[model samples]
Target: MNNNKILDVAIVGYGPVGQTLAILLGRMGYNVAVYERWQALYPLPRAVFHDHEIRRVFRMMGLENELEKVSQPSACYQWFNADWKVLVEIDWSAESISDGPFGYLFNQPSLEAILDRQAKAIGNVQVHQGWEVLGLSQNDATCELNMRKVEGDGAGETRTVQAKYVIGADGANSIVRRECGIEWHDLGFDEDWLVVDLQPNAGVELDVPDIGQWCNPARPTTMVPGGPGYRRWEFMRLPHESVEDLQSTEKVWQLLSPWVTPETASLVRHAVYKFRSRIAEHWQQGRILLAGDAAHLMPPFMGQGMCSGIRDAWNLSWRLDLVLKGICSEELLNNYTTERKPQIQAVIEASMAMGKVVCVADPQAAAERDAKFLSGQVPPLPPFPGLEQGLVFKTAKAGVSGSLGIHGAIERNDKVERFDDAFGRGFFLLSIGEDPLQSLDEKLLGELNQLGVRSVRLSKDGAPGTCRDVSGKYHQFFEENQLQAVLVRPDFYLYGGVSTHSEIPALVQSLCDEVSLKREPCAQLSQAKVAVR
Candidate 1:
């Protein structure tokens, strides 16, 4: 750890969120240092689900092909009652607007390993495994991290590293969060559950549930398929069950008796976890920020525990890039906490709601709840919430800003590929009809060019320098929404949109002002289009 040079960012805890942020920053050509107390990946599986929106992020990292190797597309998530009657079913296999499956099932260790490998490959990212963060403090110029090497050659040695900014991606019981004086705002839902992961014995024959919720009052349990030949079961701790009692190996097998015995399966790992729902009162303080489990914790009923953390990383990456590159003010980073807190809070509430459904204990209460759901009076599933506030421009020509941007396969060269792969990353100006550049004045175009924004003209048929919307969804999205052009952020969220070509310049200027783009550039801005063909 070099103490003299001022690094761009220092990340505490090199879990998935920390690694993702490190990789994103490294790819953007920033100097990053990640400190992890643990020298290796946590061998147990924790999170198991991610949606298409997250898949798009993986696509942004250029890891879609690698991700497919470790993930399995999930089927519908169906809930059943004591009598085996269906309560509510969420169809995860349904196609999303992003032109992919609604969700995916994966092992957390595999996902983290993929992120770690990619992050280490980046030229500027340095991983300090076995280095434990001891304390954090910030002066006017930089934040200083005090760390000690916990293992290997430097076992008991202490050192200091300096960075312009520091982020805490440490898990729950985060030292960084505590050092920043952030408190937890508990959502009040807590339960003790046994999480058991196992692989079936060779040639074991038995009918097992595939990703089903058994809501029986006798024992409310969840069985989920984890990739190929792997299964997970979560059994809720009953009223009479004690944490100590449930932790015994003999007792654990008893809970698994209904599903499998030691004869029929090989026990991989089992642990008693008290699932908690909590979010930090403040996510950012001065030059320090918190992400992942350090910022929020949620029940895994929706499988969003890890997904929300990954979202935090992606949401902060671009903003940090703009600020570090001096394209935006440091105050812009405040949007991270402002924007992510509400979104993660919503996810926590929704997960708690689902937890209430699956954690029912009393027979009468479970029966009444199931009856209400079975009698065709069920509540509709909540629509995915968009950015409600912070940094989003809400008053575009069509009032469609703050919504998630759509993705589709584009025809380029002799291959069909994801839009991001063909168009590259960063701010994008996409038009459906005419070339959007024709509509922009030199001043607005110069502003966009100076900000490193790319312009793409999309058409149904191939044109010189224009991308072909092979899926036809991008064109249909424009037609259905009555939008001629849209400005999309790097994280695939709508910055703003214009209904007519004439409104393009104004939209560009609005975005320029919102992002605080510089008027001058190192070189004069040019009227150049990104060559896709």
Candidate 2:
């Protein structure tokens, strides 16, 4: 091992979250590496489901399309009364959501394989198999990591690696979380469950991949679909039942009972484990930090354990890009936990609510769970100001438009024209007239463009413009104070405006420049648009 080599980031695990984070940063031109304890893809059927955010993370790795190829088609999660009567079916489909992709049910190992391949192909990512990280320490500028090759019987030598930052993507029993000296504030109700993974004979249809959750307060089972014609069932163990003892063929058959027939199913795998809901006390401390199970581990009730971590990856990735690339201040990075903590806290609470409602055993508790399920009570989705659907960006007519650019609901099948001219995936500028922005000269505009300054103009809405997405409503909002266009960020935070083509560069700089300068948090820039742009 080259102990003295340095990387832009050092990831502590190579599961789904770690591998995806590595490939994401590596593709962004950052030097990255992984310390993985697993020498190879281990036992299958670990993680069975992932939510929409996972889809977004996979897309960042350029695998969203590929995933659909191998992903199983699943749509509904149905509640059941132990006797097999269906209660309520919650349908999840991503045909209209912006972030894209609803959710999927597939074996975790396969997903990891796909991400691992991408990590290995990247020249900027170096992954070490069977390397157990011993400990780490970091200042603001860099980090030092200690590790030993676990695969070797006596390879006990520790190597030191220099890294600008470290992510703890290990499992719940994370050494990184431990070394950080943080603890989880628990949500109660720890219980044991037995997971049975088996192959069904061709033409056998017992339980649909459409997860059937038995919330009868009687017995709750979460059924998930494995890729390519396979399914697994997770059932809570009755008090005093031992999955270790159930490892016997007869015992396994007993557990598989009710769901599979003796002749229709063949046992492929089974495991027993218990878990509780938890969140990391601290997501980041200094240059060393945490993500995924290292940060939060809720029960798999919502099937969001791994997906939540993936969300952390995407959130952290863009901020890391800004900071590492000299576009933002590190204090803005502090908002990482700020933005994500609330979201994860919600996940933990929701998962806990699920455990309490669905895992009912007592008659009274079961009745309450059943009453809640039957009453058709659905929790409200978290409110985010950025998520309201509509033509989000209105053209602040930088002293150009007759009215605030038109803002309205984008109709289905509406042609968005060309988004290439619009600012996107970053803060950009737009122009409506022929005027050169007043704030910047041609030379300055050229420099801003070199620094990734983006601007565009449409003499009219139908003409050449940056309407990158037409399915989405891109309303025209016109403002008199601004120039001919507007600039928006990836997160859709309003950054600045262009009063003239010349002013576009300075507007972009004003919104993003100070983060790279000396400061903790960047000053907020606000913008106003007309009724429609």
Candidate 3:
């Protein structure tokens, strides 16, 4: 048995969530170790869609160009009845605060390949494939993982590794979550469905609705783009059919015959998936934490299954980074579940609501649903939830805290580009007409710098030390919200905002308190109303 050196972070799965965390932390120069039982990336397609928020995350990793080549923007999502009458339409092409298309469709394998290459390119990230984690134990100081090689030379060799924190991004059947004695809280949604992936042949363009759902009671189905060169269809398994019978090649062909044939398109893969809605009771226990599918699982109705997991990684990365740097205590991790669970729960409920609408198997119920939609009585889809609590500033006034911050084109150093590209990614103290740092005292300024908070002044006049808001988005945001200074977290969420620049120091001071930055109390300001939301 060999004992490996302690790592700053240990990831137990090599899926996109784990890979994302590795890349984010490794780029920050943290020593990250990733363990996976598989020797190579999964070749089959799984998740096929990601929203603009995820696009922003990938852009932060400098994968914008690479992702563009393999992805196609989603124009819209439509749901239709058996008669082909449109019941609902979601505009996925609408502009988002992330400054891009609302959603995108791409091949999961290609995306994983891109993330794999990026993760390996970072010298600080050590990816250990073919290593199966058999057991895990965590003390107050560190977590230890017991594992053995499952493939290649010295396959039977066992080793123990240590990490300050361990994250389980290992799929639904997660070993890390099990070891921590965490139980799942089932949200009462489970249904079996057959998923089929196809690649059309040359010059073959089958006639079908692009990204629409056929909500027919006889055979509820879903048709959408799988990626650049692929298409996917899903059929809800009727009660009369067995899962085994639905997955057969003959049945698959029959289900796909309406739109494609053996010559028009080639079958890539087909399987029956039991869409479930479940969330773990706890996401963290001691130094062991859960992320991605390990933390929550929802039906694929909204296509946020993978997106939600990536959000978990993004939320955890910064908190872990702060803890590893000793800038914050481990107690800061308590906010992990506090901030993410509610949003994920809301998503699960929404997806389940959609599933109920689409998975109707009765003739009368389907007719009623269609009539309600046709009558315009059905309500619109609920907006996606944001951070309503935990580590965010609360004010008596209606503030922009817990909302996603805006991003737009800005001109800096005679070059025009996206806000992130122009100023870089981190905690940003953005002021509209003046320098936000000027209000901060030396102590607060030093702490802000230590926290890697970047202060930027934006204006249309192009004054010295201020970037030009080329797109006028910054001006609009500040004006609409009646805010002069805004504090944005690394995840692009607004911590809080102030209507005046003098309150900037108070906002910064509140942040210092929230993040557990040890500093002496500065003189109080009358307008400073910083409390946790």
**Which lDDT tens digits does candidate 1 get at residues 274-320?**
99999999899999999999999999898898788888899889889
- Can you write out model 2's per-residue Cα lDDT over 336-363, one digit (the tens) per residue? 6755676677777777766766677776
lDDT of 3 by residue, 63-165 (tens): 9999998899997899999999999999998988789889999999999999999999999999999999899998889999999999877899999999989
**What RMSD does each model have against the real structure?**
2.0, 7.3, 3.6
Q: Number of backbone collisions per candidate, in order?
A: 0, 34, 0
TM-score of 2: 0.78
Give candidate 3 misplaced runs (Cα > 4 Å). 396-399, 520-533
- Which portions of model 1 show Cα errors greater than 4 Å? 397-399, 463-465, 520-524, 529-533
Tell me the lDDT of model 1 at 222: 89
Ranking by lDDT: 3, 1, 2
Residue pairs with backbone atoms closer than 3 Å in model 1 (clashes): none
Estimate the overall C-alpha local distance difference test score of candidate 2: 0.64
> What lDDT is obtained when candidate 1 is compared to the true structure?
0.85
- Can you give the lDDT of residue 58 in candidate 2? 61
Residue 500 accuracy (lDDT) in model 1: 91
